[model samples]
Target chain A: MEVLRLQQQLIELTNSLFQEGFLDDQFTQLQMLQDANNPDFIQEVVTLFAEDSERILAELTKTLETEPIDFKRIDAYVHQFKGSSSSIGAQRVKAVCVDFRAYAETENREGCCQALQQIKQEFFLIKSKLEALLQLEQQILAAGGSLPVME
Target chain B: MENVDGDESQPGREETGNLQNLLCGKKILVVDDNRVNRIVAAGALKKYGAHVECADSGKAAIAKLEPPHTFDACFMDIQMPEMDGFEATCNIRKLEEIAKESGKIWHVPILAMTADVIQATYDECVWCKMDGYVSQPIEEEQLYKAVSQVLSRT
Candidate 1:
């Protein structure tokens, strides 16, 4: 009964993420790629994404604070951020990055700063959500129940 | 599951080309400065039964191609730090030219694996003499198609 409840929660949470546009089809592709031989593939990729995003975010913060801010450098960092976020299907974060890149291209400091904050917000939001989801997955597995497949 | 060659079902072989078979026994090199990107690409290629090797940077990739290069194909990221894909491809081409001078004629096809599929990006890829490109996030069908296309040429 507990396993069933966990499964239901997992499914519902996953549906909400997609419905709210927190994730995209790319996440589904990642899930599909995970198999018996590589059961932790998604977990590994998510961990990597989170770590990489933190590094890029820190870089963006530092670079933005420099004198005579180099928009080119800002653009490059955002581009890297965008790639990693999109790779993990962090749709909201990736969306902010698209706007962030445009602001950087135009050398708009105010616009870039605002976008940076926006990106950071989205990143943290998704990070917590993903962490919750992964934790729930672990709980289900530990309870001897298989993960619920997302429809 | 062990059908690495993906040639087990010969009946539907012609009609439906097995996706896994496309990369069977092929060796692929994936170069990306980003750790996550490299892991993602390598994982996907391994699923398709391709022996995969990785280089964290363009310089590392160049080092791997020292001599008697055995990689069947390479997927290179475009916007890496230090040395980008275009520069790496240029350097690799120079090495190929040197190898050609020594009476070895070989060109290992390089596919630009990038997130930006813009017109300018494609233009630059061509200008760098790249065979083709695959988009980032590494979709399976696209990866297979690009790899098969390049492998067929050589």
Candidate 2:
């Protein structure tokens, strides 16, 4: 009963990851780095994502607030965020990065902030979706089932 | 939706060949994390009469590939949680030997899809050796072109 419920949840999470693109190669490699020795790999990686995202957001905010907006600095910051998000397959955030980068390129401070806010929203969405996925995985294991199979 | 670009888009269907039967005999694998995305892709390809399978992540996609697999091509999303398109594509490429040994008609093609459609993004696509790519906000005609270009097996 619980197992079946968990299975459904697991599938939902998996689908969200696909829709959002947070399960790409870089994320997978991070997953592969996990084992019984370090079972908290996924959690650790998520924490990193959260922490890193916060830092990037902070920097983006600072740059946007500058009277004479530093577009180059903003571009660099966006570029960094873009790479990290790209590696993890954070589709929504990565998509936002494109806009932010363009705005930075043009030194459109307000546009950069707008893109930042959007990325922030997407970040939370992906985070929640991933938490749901992780919870389902734990439940599946608790139910004595193998992880949900994709495909 | 036959390329419904609000009457401002280009041709809906390609005139090169009968795309309906183009992939009739081809087997395709859709590797994406989202079920909706996978279903959308499969549903679209099914209209063209091709057999379809789906993987929720890169990890899942790799596990499904075997000598017995008869995929003419794969439509892989760039980002997935378990394994990414790049890794999955590499894995599929490595399976070429086994695919040949199994007497399959042709080697598989891998196409990358993403919402990340920028100039740099395209360069990355080429870097990944993606046979083809389709941008996000995916339309029917764009999808058809991608599938047709990759599935030119018939």
Candidate 3:
């Protein structure tokens, strides 16, 4: 019964994440990659995403702080961030990165800064939601239950 | 409604099993500057039963391939700091030529792993003698398909 309860919780949380636009089908792809042999697949990828995102965000912040801002370098960093976010299916963060790149390309300092803030806001929101989802998965596993299939 | 015995019925299990069979015991190298990229690529390949080794940069990859040339295949990441994938692939081809001249026939297949899938980007990989290309955010099926395609050629 504990397994069932945890499974239902995972279902609801995942649904909410999708409904809220924090994730997309790519997240489902990531989940599909997990199995008994690689039970930690989603967690590992998410953790990597979290670490990589943080580092990229810090670099972006520093790069934007300098005079005569190097738009090319900023674009490169944003490109990397966009790729990582898209890879992990962080939909909103990736979306903001798209806008961020446009600002970087035009060398618009004000626009770029605003886009960076949006990216941060989206990243943190999705990161916490993903962490919660993973925690629920752990709870399910601890209860001797497998993760319920999404969709 | 569906049985979840953690068996073949699982969504990707059968495909994963097939990939493991195709890649099992194959020695492969993953070269990428990003630790996260390396980990993700290595993890996926390892899950499919490939014996995976990694190099943090193109130069390190070249060092690993010198003389011995033991790796069955390689996944080379583009856009590294010093030597990008194109340069690295070119160097690897040079090494192959030298090995051939020395009466040692060695042709290690290399696949470019890039986030950029532009037509010109792929053409550049082929120009540098890379066997094929795999797009980034590496999916399991795509990785397996690329590996199989490259291996099939040789």
On TM-score, the candidate that comes out on top is 1
Each prediction's whole-model lDDT (CA): 0.82, 0.67, 0.81
**TM-score of model number 2:** 0.47
Residue runs of model 2 more than 4 Å from their true location after superposition: A20-38, B1-154
Model 2 agreement with the true structure over B80-154: per-residue lDDT tens digits = 655778877777666766677767644467778674555326567666666887654244566677767766554
> Residue B31 in candidate 1 has what lDDT?
97
lDDT of 2 by residue, A1-151 (tens): 8888788877876766765555543344344435564566567556666677788788878878878877888886776566556545566677788888888888776787789889889888887877777777887898798766554
Q: Fnat for model 3?
A: 0.22
Writing each residue's lDDT as its tens digit, candidate 1 over A54-133 gives: 98899999999999899999998898888888778888888899889999999999999999999999999999999999
Q: Chain A TM-score per candidate?
A: 0.98, 0.83, 0.97
Model 1 error, position B58 (Å): 1.1
Which CAPRI quality tier does the interface of model 1 achieve? acceptable
What ranking emerges by DockQ with the best candidate at the front?
A: 1, 3, 2
lDDT of 2 at B83: 73
Model 3 residue runs over 4 Å out of place are B1-18, B140-145
Predict model 2's lDDT versus the native. Answer: 0.67
